[model samples]
Target: MTVCEMCGKETEVFSAIIEGSELTVCAACGRFGKMLRKPVMRVVKKQAVEKAPGPVETVVTGFASLIRSAREKAGLTQKDFAMSLNEKESIVQKLENGAFVPPISLAKKLEKLLKIKLVEFEQEDEVSNEKRGSGPLTIGDILNVKK
Candidate 1:
């Protein structure tokens, strides 16, 4: 079985052109696009494997100290650094004091200016649902249960 590119649902899908992009989507999502081909049903499998989660970019620990030290070594005051970044001095002060966690965009800017590593990519482990089994059946599944 294929996964829908739009909804991330595992089911039969069809190739479609959506908003100038070609994507494989399920029936419900296919409505928004021009279907290039009809969905072909396949034998259902007892087990379905989900794709592993992608790596996430997160600000590193001790970011406040790193930024402060870098800025000091560069001989730039808080106001000067803020002006260079086109940001307010209060924002820079908060970042240096550990009172604020910079977003990805801000972190990237700091890394470029300070030449320090502030962002790290973390890989999340895949969770196996087989051991836990499926949770309580939904109303739709219960209604579809065979006698």
Candidate 2:
């Protein structure tokens, strides 16, 4: 016997998803959500060695405009594009309107379907525009010394 989540009565509890929330409730309260089956637990062994993380990749800006243009160029409507990508039309609308950025998997699908570059790699050794236009560099500027 355990505590009832909603009524606070001491009794057995079952897992249920009520109003988009998962809770442990009694049979009476379980009516609020669909009854969920008990989850199974399994144990596994881990490797002795751990690998280091890899470099981060980033999505390019102006993706919304690019997507819209590509879709238009392909002579496909939003509904047609969604059907081609196997995604919802609303998702296509949101992606085209810049309301959201698709996950990596979805981005890959877009790249394949539209033939446009959406993701770019970040280079740590790259020099930025700010460094290039820092008002005519001198030896001291290169060596980081006080003028």
Q: Against the true structure, whose TM-score is highest?
A: 1
Q: For each candidate, give its TM-score against the true structure.
A: 0.56, 0.50
lDDT of 1 by residue, 3-44 (tens): 999999998889999999999899999999899996556678
* Model 2 spans with C-alpha error above 4 angstroms: 1-53, 123-147
Where does candidate 2 clash, by residue pair?
Answer: none
Tens-place lDDT digits, model 2, residues 1-147? 777788898787888899998887889999989889543334688967843444556678899999999999999999999999999999999999999998878988899999999987765332334555657755543453337
Question: lDDT values of the candidates?
Answer: 0.89, 0.82
RMSD over all Cα atoms, model 2: 14.0
> RMSD to the native, candidate 1?
13.6
Q: List the residue pairs that clash in candidate 1.
A: none
**Top candidate (lDDT):** 1
C-alpha lDDT (0 to 100) for residue 63 of candidate 1: 100
